[model samples]
Target: MEINHLTAAEARVWRAFARGETVDFRESPDEDPADGGDWGAERTLRAGVLRALLLDGPRQDGEVPSLSVAGARITGRLDLQHATTDHPVRLRNCHFDEAPRCYAARLRELNLSESLLPGLVAHAVHVDGILRMTRTRFTGTVRLGGARIAGSLYLESAQVSAPGTEVPVLQLNQASVGADLSAPGLRTQGQIRLNGATVAGSLNLSDARLGNPEDAALDAQTLTVGGDMLLRHAEVHGWLGLRGARITGRLDLSYVLLSNPGGSALQASSTAVGELWLRKAPPMEGTLNLRRAQLDVLFLEPDSLPQEVLIGDLTYTSLVPHEPAERRLPMLERQRDGYVPHAYEQLTAAYRRVGDDHAARLVQLAKQRRHRNTLPWYGRLWGLVQDVTVGYGFRPMRAAGWLLSLLAIGSVAFALHHPQPLKAGEAPPFHPVFYTLDLLLPVISFGQEDAFAPSGGYQALAYVLVLTGWILATTVIAGVTRTVSRQ
Candidate 1:
């Protein structure tokens, strides 16, 4: 219950300002300056008086401000808890001793450009217009959690630095904004959390510097954004987490410099987006983990792909350049620990989903070839032999091709036999094709192999055909088993 004291000249300034009239430090322009000698001294205003004026003041449409108090430093905390106002609060280059706690307050617009504030607590506060804080410096944490904003929120070139190390500098958890959230050229120390927040327009953070070496710098878990999240040409020392987010537009991180060293730079697990743009000149340098992400278009250049990035379980519908199976080689080649089965499988499935079975088989073939090359010398030899005979279970028709070739060669040898007789002459079913099939197949009995009695080279060739049948049949069985296990 502290009372605010005002001087005689300051009393006149407040009366004129509340009446929608203009007044300088001394008096009106018609009054003489010699009437007030101490008007040249600097003025100090209490926080309670500023809060009262904001609640009771009426804004007239003119060149004059609604409540313009220049060169005055606020003493106590301006607690406008749940107060509703319609006028715009414009405070320029002023200093606040404590943070203005406008919790659940309904405001029209707030323009604190070039001001120095300790912090700001506007949780669940409704604003119909923009919250402009251009070039302002916030020494403490600014929590705008659950706030609803109709217009844009501009923090252009602002500096928000908290005293602690691990906590977030700006908290916007569950906050909903209708327009853009432009924080270009902003320099912040701790993390900027936007967990479960919804932004209707774009979030342009281009050319900003976010540094938090201990942990993630921007934790935007489950954030639903209507437009782009532009971090182009920005620099982040910590991680960028967007796990389970739904972005309507592109997540543009082109030319963004991020370094988290051993940890993940961007963990976008289960995120659904229209397009993911990482087509930078030098590419991103950190470990980008995009597991379980579904994107319509993913634009990635060959040179820009990082050596340690991972896209396991990621499914993209349309890749650029039309031929994605061949064009996506650089990304798979850049894996750190070599072959990842899910990455290749996901890409192959995407191509198959688009009705490109030819490209899908090519991707499967490429995955096997690249994986075999990374194996040891003995393993590579075994893999190559399996591929030549059976196509690594990817082509079961190759095993059929081998069986048909052997059957044709053996059929020609037996068809030109010198002496071929039937057993007991009981109307023998001995033909070239039926006898060859009996020799190739182990289970089927066409009574042609036992009925025919061969001599000279035919008998010796029959022994080779019997062994070749088992080998080809075993190869086919092995190929089928391998395919079943993979599925």
Candidate 2:
């Protein structure tokens, strides 16, 4: 494989490479410097017709030092398939107006660091190592679908602007990364899809901005992150869907702002997080649906502003119901009987912060259900009285008091009607002893007539005294019993 100069047709290929069009070129052996050094060794073409071109061939090992396509306006397709190089390939400030396809192009490293391209269609583009794109601007849609690489894919501070002529911005379908996906300060105009993608390391999306409101900003379905999924400070104008995604470590969405109106702001349903710290997320119009999601511990630290942290019907059961007695310390622990009530209380507080009175009331009712069996003593007593008043259609306490007062009055009337005879010899029309025997037992006996017998008026007075004492004793006993029962 000797070094060859660019012919008329080959010069056209060289011109396409200069214009930033996709090209597949084969490698050629470098001429010995000891010799007059093949003057046409380096490939060069004048910049003009920027269109799609493919350059492919076999090159001598260690021939080309670098593939430099510096400044040109290349439009249409560009494919650099299976091209080997020792040093970095630089495409610095070239303008690619159309789609530039680079499939299976092997290079030491591709540095499109500060290039202006409308769209980059690089499918299965294999770099020998990393592909660094720092501050590169993509004016139109960019697709890297089904690309595989052994090293990291760094896109730090890359801006993906929406096309002015009604076109989508970026799509990363089924792209796998062996290392971290550091897209910090990544701005996308249309939907960014990472469905069915696998990242061996962390997926850092800090300070990323998704500008599309109607379309989903981050569709990360079934994505598996080997490390933590850091989305801190990420602003999504649309929904951030992480449905069925699995994060091996903590999922930190601390200060993420999700402002989607129609759909849920954050749909992490069926996703698993080792630990979730959603401390201060931006206000969302819709619910943050996390139903059926599992977490080791969900932290809800207090925030400066009053924020409502809605925890949807989450089923959280303690892994260890009973800790060792020696390890247990007395703190504000939620007991078995109090777990449901405490959870309900927390839910109520959250809803109340957002001024959702209906939700708060619903939670309160659920709490009441938890304590249904254990009513306060006073409450139970009040309920009993009400039931008695309504059930039997009789106020028993009021009726009993009225009947007792009437019996006392009748006794007094009888005593006044039939006054005891002054003379005992003239037998009294009625022997008062029968009625007075039970009442006046302490004062008199039957056997001792002389000592037992008193004047008739005095006997009447004794009867009155006995009756008053008996009534007072019964009333006091009844009052004491009622008080003890209530307590």
Candidate 3:
């Protein structure tokens, strides 16, 4: 129905939409327009200068269709309170110079695509269909607090300019979305807050450049996503805070460059993700905080093939035990390149818990290689010895050396205690030779009287000689046994 004629109330709404003035429904006349069942449909409100005031009460379904306010400069509030639409509401290329309020409006498939929106405000705005805003430019604060969207919300190529002129930027606080929130190629100069927003589908921010060196950037707190959160190739010049955010699927951050040289860069505490992929990302200048984050096996796979994957700082439980040399060597080698110091520390801690101090120290040393090779040759030799002793179970040479040392000590103690008897034509036995033979030998035999006599020292010498011969024979026998076994 055509609404060319203006009653006092209709005239006020027309003047508000035309001049961008805020209409205070509380202060307006008490006449109820819907009581007469005459809500205007297909209404056109053209160019006007609007100011600050409220517009209350609900509008009938299909009561407003194809409302166009093209090229109009909205300087104040424009509240479409509790308004429901059956068809798409188009507001193409409208310039909002001041804060425009549209609280609790039920908009189905609203199209503000390519609109120059600056300082726009929408609290509790429920959208049923797609809210398409392709290439829209938001220069000041634009809020969508407590809004619920049922379909895909596209903000493709939208440029949210810096908030320097006493105004803030886009905010979507406590908003819930049923489908994906795609914002590909979004360039935000000011902060874009999406705190406590829930998304049923993926949150795609691919190729989005956010924040400036002098201003605050994206602040997405407690954002819960059912699907993957893709931020591939996105560049954040300031802080990108995602504290307490939870993603059920993988958090794909491949090729993302987050540069906050002077401030905290990326903070994602208590965040949960299936896997966090950071393949080919540039070296982060600031902290990439993921404190108390849970990661799965997909994040721990080797970065090369037959196991080719991206290698980075990862914190996870040990995949190998402390005793197996074969299993631990591969993991050690993986830390040779791209090893984050904190991740290496985590790995070492896990190893230490399994009583694998040698492996723990090895990883620590490998991580130190990034800064300086402070480990000396002797230190590395000691580390190698410890590794072999704990990991390989190869300590035959060590056992043999200890056994020989004990025998030498015992022989010396016996020689000093008992003096040799002077034979008529023979000289006293040489002590060194006796001790050496006793240590090197494996068998000894002596009569009881000879062992107890003053001449027992000579007998001890004889016992050492016989033991040396027996040890040589046993070695020869063992060699033959091994050869026969091999054959």
Candidate 4:
């Protein structure tokens, strides 16, 4: 602390505090703090007075007052820029004419909890201890850009209302917190921006009301949190964006009611979370976009899936479903229309990554079935044929089975019929079984079926074998082409 002499006016306010006087900033004693401090006769003290009291007040040997100034109206701006003070300043229930400018200020601790003010501007401020502003009402924007706090930021039940549309009620841009950003039960008219922020502890937003409808309720882009980001049981009337964020712990949205029309309710693209939980939550009103996210675990509840969701390149390590894959896969469709192949692919890939091959196959099979159901009647028929014959171009063994069955039947029919010898042929006697082989394989001829004559059911059956062989051969070629192309 730098030692400094106080100005005459500064000394008067200092002496008054030392003498235990009630400094009244309010014009009328009848007005409540909820009136937004508009009718206040503020007593503006110079910055030097505060600096002097913090520097020399303790050494005055109990001469300084307890710094209690309840219902006081602080006029002008209380500038604490770049001043490092160890003493705690707590002005409870006070009204400020202008916002307290604490930019680049280092403080031991601060408690303005339950006070009515225009706003709070605390850019680049570092507090060694807690910064409490709980239950306070702000008529303007509370900007905390680039702040570094050593302890928790308590704002539980705080009401921050920004006048204009799309303006942020509370801004914590690029701020670094050592502990939680506790703001449970907070009511705000504008969005809460926490872009580029880093929190060492959890972010408690339980039971809070956030943002106007269709606007971003909470903007947390590039935020890195060491602990959980809890939004459980909260009501968000707008979008909750967490793009490019990294949560080392769980990101809980349990029982949260999110509503954003036309756009996504939750846009968490490129975010990496330990667990992306949505258990017991009401179905989100808008799209729950999870594009390019890396989630270690996904915990979803029954009938609680959002009305629409689009997941592209989303990777999860596990899916905790209470039902079997057969039942679960059918109900997991979140797209409003058309089949999304990536949805199935993502699920299959996640199961495969966890070494659950059975689960992966089950999801893949369900994917094929559902995909076919979305097609036209003709398309569905074609899909069925492909599935039955070659398992959607994935089972060549089934094609082999069909060919072998036809070949065996052809051989038996020719042997029972006993075809007559050819009139003009160098091969003396026509062997019935060998003749059947010639007709079956279109690509190869053994010079027997070409030279023999067969009567009765033998002739009709031989033609059938030829046609069936052509169909199987063509399908095999088509399936092989499709399989190779897909790879």
Q: Pick the candidate with the highest TM-score.
A: 4
lDDT of 1 by residue, 20-90 (tens): 45333323424321222233334556677777677764344564435555445666898988998876777
The per-prediction CA RMSD against the true structure, in angstroms, equals 7.2, 16.0, 13.0, 6.3
Scored by Cα lDDT, where does model 1 land?
Answer: 0.77
By TM-score, how accurate is candidate 3?
0.58
Model 4 pairs in collision: 25-73
Query: Model 4 scores what on Cα lDDT?
Result: 0.77
Ten contiguous residues minimizing lDDT sum, candidate 3: 301-310
- Pairwise TM-score winner, candidates 1 and 2: 1
Each model's lDDT comes to 0.77, 0.56, 0.58, 0.77
User: Can you tell me which runs of candidate 2 are displaced by over 4 Å?
Assistant: 1-64, 69-72, 81-88, 103-108, 164-168, 302-366, 369-487
TM-score of 4: 0.74
Using lDDT as the yardstick, the better of models 1 and 3 is: 1
Query: Ranking by TM-score, best first?
Result: 4, 1, 3, 2
Tens digit of lDDT per residue, candidate 2, span 42-148? 33222222111223333344354344554434444455555444445565545555556676565567777656676676766666667767767887777766666
